[model samples]
Every structure is written in C-alpha cells, then in structure tokens.
Target: MTLTTLKQRSLLGLKDLSKDEIVSLLDRAAHWEAQPVKVNPVLQGKFVANMFFENSTRTRFSFEVAEKRLGTEVLNFSAAVSSVQKGESIYDTVRTLESMGIDAGVIRLKPIGVLADLATRIKVPLINAGDGNNEHPTQALLDIYTMRKQFGELKGLTVAIIGDILHSRVARSNLWALQKLGVNVRFCAPPNMVATELDAAYISIEEALKADVIMMLRVQLERHENGMIKSAEEYREQYGLTVERAKRIAPHAIIMHPAPINRNVEIDDELVEHPQSRIFPQMENGVPVRMAVIERALG
Candidate 1:
C-alpha cells in the first residue's frame, strides 16, 4: 500500500501493522536521513495538537519537532495547565480540541483504553505516545530503527532485554516490534521486577545471550511502594549486567539501553563503554525516528 493510505492513521501498537507498512516507514525514514527534506508547506495552514498527560522529555519534543518540520503548528496541552485538573472529563476536553478543528492529535495518556474511547468520538488521527504500562509505539519504531542501523539487520538476531519489564512501555514495545521483525528476544529481571504476563519459553536472559544484541531498560523505583529501593546492591546482584557477563556474548553482539540508565543498578559502568554498546546511537536516533513517525502521520 502507498504511504498515503497511512494518512490520518493512528499508530497505537506495532502488532496491527504489517511488515510492508513497517518497511515503508523505514524506507521513508532512510530518505529523510540521507537528505534534508522540508515538510510540504501545504500543512502550514493546518494544526496538530499534543495532549501529554504525563511529564516527558523525548516523546513530547519529538512530536513538536516532527509537526513543525512538517510545516504544521503544534499546541501543547498538559494536564497541569489544562482543565483536566479542574474536573474536565476527557470527553469534554477532546471535544474542545475538536471544536477548534485540530488536524490530528498525539496523546500520552494514563488510563488503559482511553485512546480507544477518545478515538471513537474524535474526528482526527490519534497517536498514542504511551498509555500507562500498555505500549509506546513510536518509541518501539525508533528503537528498531536504531537496532537496524547498528546491527545492519534484525532477522536471525538474538536480543536480550534486561530490567523492569512490568512497568516499561519501552520493553513491551520492543518485544512486539523485535519479534515481528524476526529477532529473538529474551528478558532478565529479579523475579519480582518483571511483569507476570511476560511468559515465554525463549524469554530467558541466559538463552538470549546467544543473541547478537542486548537491550537494557532502567528500573522504575518510583512506581514501587516503600518509598526507596530496599537495597540497590541486592537488586543489582541478581540482575545487573557486569563486565564479566559482557565477555560471554557473541563478538558481534551489541548492547543497548533505553536512556536514563541507572549506572550500577541494571548495568556496569565498564559495559557502557564497550565497543559493542549501541546505547548512545539509540538515544541519538530518537530525533530522526520521531521525525519519521511525524512525517508519516501528518505528511
């Protein structure tokens, strides 16, 4: 199908996307990466709204950049500043944005199925930045883009994802995206750190070590009770990736991390500097990958 078919489309998860759609996005991204392309000014007269209910650094800025680069104006709406804090229901808030003729909306929400509910009534395309621990489709797309660039290909590769799987949208998105792209994925966490729903035979960190890539996620201590980590040292002992662990992987295997790493919590400092580490590149690629998503969503 043509990229135009994706027009006014909402990207909420990778599971619903076909391989062709995924490749089309990557192909388009390749063109953007190789050249400086301007957003067709046709959209200059249009508007895109960002409705972020939570605090963010990358997702929020990336959407703004993508929309502006596409020649569209963006209006940022945060809960702290919006009427939602004053008891405005999501139904009323979305209707308000719609009344102003929003061309499209990108939402980072909390309640599960909130987007589904909003989509039923909203007239514009809606992209889900994140919804609780559900999914972060854009983040997953960027992640795959980073991995493809780093390893040159994703198929036939083994990838290990270590850390708090239960609370990580990054991990959930990565698992689905990588698996769909034909990469083997494994998880490693202290028993309780991982989600109960994460059960797969190939899901062991040890088995995935035979992999060509290792992606690490940071622990979400803020989401836990008891205020602080009971013992940071104990948490690391069973799950932290040390220099010695790095030596056991394939020579071609790469290391990755979704940013804001916990240093000694989920990974060793020495492993961060290894030649095989692709964490920095992953972080850097966030801009262009996001640019690609915006271009496709609003192009």
Candidate 2:
C-alpha cells in the first residue's frame, strides 16, 4: 500500500495490477502535479532506459521528460539504429542493456507478448509503454487520472470506447483498469476491428454516445490490411465523431482520444478542443503519471 510495496514491480499491463495499486499510483501522480517547481531529485542516482521499437510521440517523449524531471539519467534506445535491425533477438538486446547497469527500462515494441517474455529474462524492472496490440499501462493510468480529475471518482461511470478495438493497446489497458475500478465499459467498433476476446458489450455508436466518457480510438491504419475499412469517408459516416454526432452526446460527457488523431477521421478537429474534450489534458497527465511509474520501479 506504499511506494515500498511497489518496488521492483514490472508494469507489464494494467491486468497485472490491483485496483488499490492503480489508485495509489494515480494519487502519487496527483501529488507530483501539485508540487511546486523545484528539483526533487527523487531518482537522481538512478539510470533508466527508454527502449522504443516502434515510433511514438506522446509516450516516448513523456517518459523521457518524466525521467529527466525526476533527475534520473536517461538512455534513449532506438531499435532502428541498434542490432535489432540486424536481426538480434529481444532477449539479447535487453540483456545487453541490463549488462550496462540500467536500473529500469520503459519499452515500446511492435510484437504482442514480447514485453511479457522479455520481462521474465531481464533483471531490471520493465515498464511497458506498449507492446503490439497487447497493452499500454501508463497511457491507461494517465487516462484514468484525467477522468478522475474531471469526475473526482471512477466508480459508477460509464465509458464507451469507440473505433479500432482490435489494434488498440490503450483500449485493452483501459478495459482492465476501468473495470477494476467499478466503471461500466462498452465497446463500439466496426465488426472487423473488434477483438472478440474482450468480453464487453457490443453497442451501436449512438448507444455509446450516452456514456459518461466517450473514448475515441485512432484507427491504426498501419496495422490494418486492405479492405479493413472501405474508405475514410464511409468510416467517418459510420464511426467517426462528427460535429453532428458530437452534438448528441450527453452535455456532461467527456470526449477522449489517444493522439496523432487523423483530424477529421476519428474525431472532428473542432470537437478536439471543445470544453468537453479531455484529449489534451490526458497528454499533460502522462508526465506525472510516468514520473510515479519510474520512481516506483526504481525507488
């Protein structure tokens, strides 16, 4: 129940965490966010690595910033420039880093289950930034933090996650985290994009609009094969959060999207900055949440 209890825990996914542990991390994040600007130096003597096998904007930069802010020395690992490009195995790569005396690692890879496997081999704690379509624990943590900041509690809130469910690590992590906190969750997506293993209610987009939180997922075009979506315009008509559709959402409902938004594709550009949208704040919350994660992993 304390930071000491979280020491050396590898955050592979939200499914591996208890509701109390999740809430404790969020509470620590809030504490960090509320502190005055000063050098806390909580992680000054530690060294952490950011090993990203996939391209990222928010997760990559946020973790780096969080590490720097906490006074931890950061090693940025680029798979493109490393032996991974030459067909080196993940075990070898992680072992190589661990040999360098890295205290902990934040990994984002493109293959599902790789993080879990690598965590077993590495001596240092491995925090999953993302692993294929498997899970993104920190993103879900920041998301819940953002929602809790808005509603002051997570219990009894209904969350409808829309769009590319099959390829969304964010969706997977959020489902586990939210369900544990007593949130009602619904999934709305094109039939092909829905992961049947999720065990959530399949609802119409209109039905989803009625939830307390409407999370729009970015359509992962890179992961989709041909014919997954007929066309962007058609996908928008059926699933995109258009201006008209946005109007019908509950007045108190909050809109959320994990970024690199395709503008008019997943969500209307105008609606992104709307008062009810928590997208930006979600990004802002990433830093403090990650700070808590790194500190806990290495503290």
Candidate 3:
C-alpha cells in the first residue's frame, strides 16, 4: 500500500516500518531508478511544502528535485522567510500551511519528537527529513539501497556503524533497518558517544568487528555540546578509521558513509577513497529513494 492510504501516513522514524515494508519500498525505488526519466505524474498538481528548520543542502534539495520529477509542485519554506522569526509555534505554522491546501509537508527540524507531535495536528502526510538527532528515515532507506547494490544482499552481512552515534539520526535509523533485515550490526564510537540502551541482541563493536561491514560517520564540532564528545582531536585519536584500522576488517568488508566527510577526523581521506567506499553512490541513491518516498507519501 502507498504510505498515504495505509493506516500510518507519517514517516517520522524507522521503527514504524517493518523489514518487508522497507524492502518493498527499496525494490520499488530501484525500479523507478531504471527508468532514467520521469514518465508518470503520479502526484500531478499536488503541492509538497519543504519545511526546513535546520541548515540543509542535500536533504532539502534532493526532496525538492524528487517531488518535481514526479510532476508535483513544491513550495519551498525557509525558516528565514516564515513566521518562525516571530516566535510562532510549529503547530501554528503547519496549520497555516495546511489551511493553504498543501498535499504533504516534509520537515527537517532540530527537536526530537517534534514531527510526531506535529503529525497529530495535520491531516496531510508528513515526512521527517531529519528531526534533531532522532531519525532520518530517508537517509536509512538510501543507505540500505546503496548497500544492496554494493554487497548484493543485506541479509547475512556484517555491518559496523562507527563514530558519533549519539548525535547521529542516520546511525539510529540504520541500526533499526539493517538489524531488522538480518544484517549483523555493530556500533563503535568513543565510549561517550557510542550507542547504549539498545537491544542486547546485536554484538557491540569490539566483538562484532570480527566480521561485518564498516560505515564511518563524520564527527563535527556541534556534538561537543551534547556532552558525549569532548574534542575533535580526541575523537580522531580514538575512533578515527585510519588505513591501519581498515586492515582489521575481513579483506572483503565494505566501507560506507553518509558523506560531508571530515577527511582525517572520523575517516582518513585515503580510506574514504578506498575501492570499497560506497559514499558517492549512497548520495546518488538519495534521489530515487526520496522520489519513491514522496510518491508513496503523496500519491
């Protein structure tokens, strides 16, 4: 079922999707990619409002392009031009947009549970592009798509999500999606930023690294305020994936990243350019997966 007419119309987090649901979306996304051009205006004449509260280049642009590719109109909303400057609540803003007859609202905000809360107020579909450090469902979908293309299958593969886990929405979503698909999941980050409170079913990094794919995340300065990271230098010294670190993986273990890399911070530049790196393709898949998501959400 397209997500809209399905009982659940909000894409707020990965926990809401089952493994089969994700695979079905991914398989459909792959089919859409093979077409090379948009053929159907499934969402024709509909309006999708891109409501972004945080700084975004890739996520926002990708969704805008994806919506237009399917023949839907897009209304771009930047926090700068909106009533947000007047201290208006998100509820009021979304209500105003819905009153204007928007078909769907895709948001990227900086507060966890904000989309879920807002979902209760709006009748149109809602897609959480990114919400605080909570979740990025589309990013996880694209990452899984890239993995399927690179490794041939997600099941039975060992995957390690390393670095900055505490503030990473991508990491959270991937853990849910990958583990659900039966991929061996491991998480490794400096102790403070590492994942905790998750199911005890999966192996921790020190143990899981014995065999699994390794995905590196960029460590930025903003995470310092989270109290999970003290300094970037310490982060690199302890958790950075250097060439020497790459040798610890089984010879065939794949490397992936959701880019805007830190070069030498979380992953060395050489490793990022390694033969197994799927970062670029991961970015490319964002287009079609998002197109699929938008279509299913608004169709």
Tens-place lDDT digits, model 2, residues 1-299: 24334334778899878998999999999988987984578889899989988888678999998999899999998887898999998778888989999889999999887777777667788899999989999999999999999999789999999999988899999999999999999999998898999978989999999999999999866544578988777788899999999999998899999887988888998999999999999999999999898878986
Name the regions of candidate 1 deviating beyond 4 angstroms: 1-8, 37-42, 196-199, 202-208, 223-229, 270-274
Tell me, by lDDT, which candidate is best: 2
What is candidate 2's CA lDDT for residue 135?
Answer: 92
Residue 182, candidate 2: C-alpha displacement in angstroms: 0.4
Q: How far is candidate 3 from the true structure (C-alpha RMSD, Å)?
A: 2.6
* Residues forming the 10-long window of minimal summed lDDT in candidate 1: 1-10
Task: Give per-residue lDDT, candidate 3, residue 255.
Answer: 79
Model 1: residue 124 alpha-carbon error in angstroms? 0.4
Cα lDDT listed for each candidate:
0.74, 0.89, 0.80
Return the lDDT, model 1, position 131. 85
> For model 3, what is the alpha-carbon lDDT of residue 55?
77
Q: Which ten residues in a row have the lowest lDDT in candidate 2?
A: 1-10
- By TM-score, how accurate is candidate 2? 0.96
- Tens-digit lDDT string for candidate 1 (1-299): 24334333767777677777776777666666665565644467778889888877767887787677667888999888878999998778877997898877888988888877787667667788888888888878777887788767779777777777777788888787778788877777666666777543335656556667778788765644664355667666756677777778888778888777888877888788788887777766666676666666665
Q: Encode model 3's per-residue lDDT on 1-299: one tens digit a residue.
A: 35356336567788779887798889978987998666557778899999988878888988988888888989988887778989998788888999999988999998787788788767888998999988999999998898888778778987777877878888889888888898877777666765677642434445544655678877877878876677777777677777777777776767788878888878887887788677787888998998888877775
Assess the local accuracy of residue 201 in candidate 3 as a C-alpha lDDT between 0 and 100: 41
